[model samples]
Target: MEPIQHKIYHVDSFHSRTFLDTYCAKKPEMDLGEECLRLTMEELHYFFKFANIKGGTLIDISIGPIIFHLYSACECFKEIILLRFNDHCIIELKKWLHDRTGAFDWTHALSFVAEKEGISELSEEKDMRLKAAIKHVVKCYDDRENITDPLVLPPADCVLVTNVLDVISKDKVDFIRNLQKFTKLLKPGGQFLLYGALNATYYIVGKDKFHLFNYNENFIRKAIEQEGFVINHCQVRPRKTESDLTDFKAIIFVSAYKN
Candidate 1:
């Protein structure tokens, strides 16, 4: 089947989510829309173990609070860097910290803001494990700049890239090439862990809709090899839900070593 071509959007994630709900949701329930959420999370644990992240730099590029929460529990990296793809997320994050207007409700940002208000209220009885996961994110916020250029990242002992590759640009080849630019920032023999889902939805720069891309693991692995990194481990999984119109699948436990 020919891949679906979604109308591109150049907005930040929040706006894109809004737009997708309005437009893409027009067809059917987005149930099973995100098919591989589980594999992504599962691969995360695998990455930490494979990279020997303890006592290393763990940089989660363009990763939101979820990654922050998980890795913060590790006590692995001497320093953890949470880099966002855009500046708007940084500003929004800060608002959740000091904004008293109580007008804006960015629930996602709360992961990094709840401590400021001591809002134990942020706790969702439904997901206690999640709420207790990354207490550091609730207390501190790291606002770093652009990630389109891999050159910006400092040398990391391990770099965990999740769901970032297929969303950057529609051109997969170029995206892989761009992703390679990050390897130089890794210390010799350092590790890079990448997790991607099959046909995942992501927000991008310029139009107004949630975009979907089927990330090919072979393409990603080959590109990592081209960049002088050795693939350590890689696996993929298809996720299913109760209302299973479609299955969300993902490539997991993919780790590459920079030699």
Candidate 2:
């Protein structure tokens, strides 16, 4: 296997290696493709049950063009908004997805992840097969406007802020704080669906900062509760990894109400 090396950071190299190796061995069908779809639909269903978001508007903070595709197809949204911090994730993402589309292409999207993660072309076949499951369900846009920042998309009925609360490890506290502040963008009584890798430690491809953070159901439920939201349901799943190690579960998905 081609090695994708990073600066010798704080990660437990030995454990990381064994972990990655193990997951690689039993690569399952419910990989990122299945996982993301499951996560997205779960978010959709949650808002439907606890909030009055249907046929209204929707905002996906820190999401991408892919979500617009989802809403467009469902015709369940009055409008769709995609927001992100102004950065290369947007720049490069725009360049890579320069073609216009009304459908979210999961394959191209996952390819971006595979490439961003530095997996060599030689390993593409493996990832491609796993990505195929979800790729078939999504499509994205080519317009640069889709990737712009400080973007206030169409007013939304529900907001999906998934796995974005944890970015830089060193400032994780502040990151969560900022995420809390960001949540105000939602209208009163709007629905907020949150997801995060409770203890994720990965880098933004090519960037030096190691993004890491941890959160459990109780931890997140309490954190968000103070902010005027009531949890309707929550699920914690072992983050899907290519590693075979058995102990590092990394995600919590929360479906909550914004009061």
Candidate 3:
């Protein structure tokens, strides 16, 4: 088998329903939902902790069809833009956002976040807030011309990139370059939130596989700092999923500010 490379980022064959069912299923029977729950909790807690982030623009640079990452953006930002590399993820996002047919239901993830926030029946409320907050879902890519081009995009106060940098980058240098692209999307001193697997080289979506840059906590910190970001918070949780799902050893979260 040949090694997966950066080009896998352009493969727009994401199986939205299959991917969600395989990873986001509530496995109370085997307690397999712990990792998903933990990530949702940590993401929500961090978003709430920075209470000052209310009512601003947020840009979500996503690589997959998963909407769980955007759950907290609804509460923090007045306008949310879901940016992707191709039609696959954007199509799924729009389907959910527009209440169209065959949308991958994000009910379980929203409910999990609601339960963590001590709201038993407010998941629907959260769902509505997210739907309302998301004003646009766009297709975008990270290239020299794309990133270096003048910013025609509305200024964002916060930019969220989750599990995307490594997948799109070929190596550490590429990762840093891509990080610059993300930072450019932000205003001066804007907030930035990132989540990704630590020391991972590959991840799977259904039966198709993709590559990841082998990044460590130290590398992430240095890369962000190089782009003039002040780290506010960082956390890493040991991976708790079955090996077949992913080979990553831990999940890393970082909240920072452009400086």
TM-score versus the correct structure, for each prediction: 0.61, 0.57, 0.88
- The segments of candidate 2 whose C-alpha lies over 4 angstroms from its true place after superposition are 1-32, 36-52, 63-74, 92-155, 168-172, 203-209, 244-248
Candidate 1 or 2, higher lDDT?
1
Span of 10 residues, lowest total lDDT, candidate 3: 1-10
Cα shift from native, residue 117, model 3 (Å): 2.5
On residues 1-259, what C-alpha lDDT tens digit does candidate 1 reach at each position? 4554554322334453332232223235545333333234334545454545564466665433233234232445555555555444444434433444532343433333344324566664313333332222212111212333423545767766665555454566546554755454577878777766565555332344445455666766777888888786777665555442222354444677877
Checking candidate 1 for backbone clashes, the offending pairs are: 9-205, 9-206, 9-207, 10-205, 10-206, 10-207, 35-248, 36-248, 235-252
Segments in model 3 whose C-alpha atoms lie over 4 Å from true places: 1-7, 27-32, 147-151
Report every candidate's CA lDDT. Answer: 0.48, 0.46, 0.74
Q: State the weakest 10-residue window (summed lDDT) of model 1.
A: 136-145
Q: Pairing residues by index, what is the TM-score of model 2?
A: 0.57
Candidates 2 and 3 compared: the better one by lDDT is: 3
- Candidate 2 residue-wise lDDT at 115: 47
TM-score of 3: 0.88
- lDDT by residue (tens digit), candidate 2, 1-259: 2222332222322222222222222245424543445444444444454554454655565432233123221334544544544232344234324433422234443344444336676344533233221211112221233423334344345667655455422343555565565565567777776766665455332224333454456667777888889887787776665542222265567767776
Quick one: best lDDT, which candidate?
Answer: 3
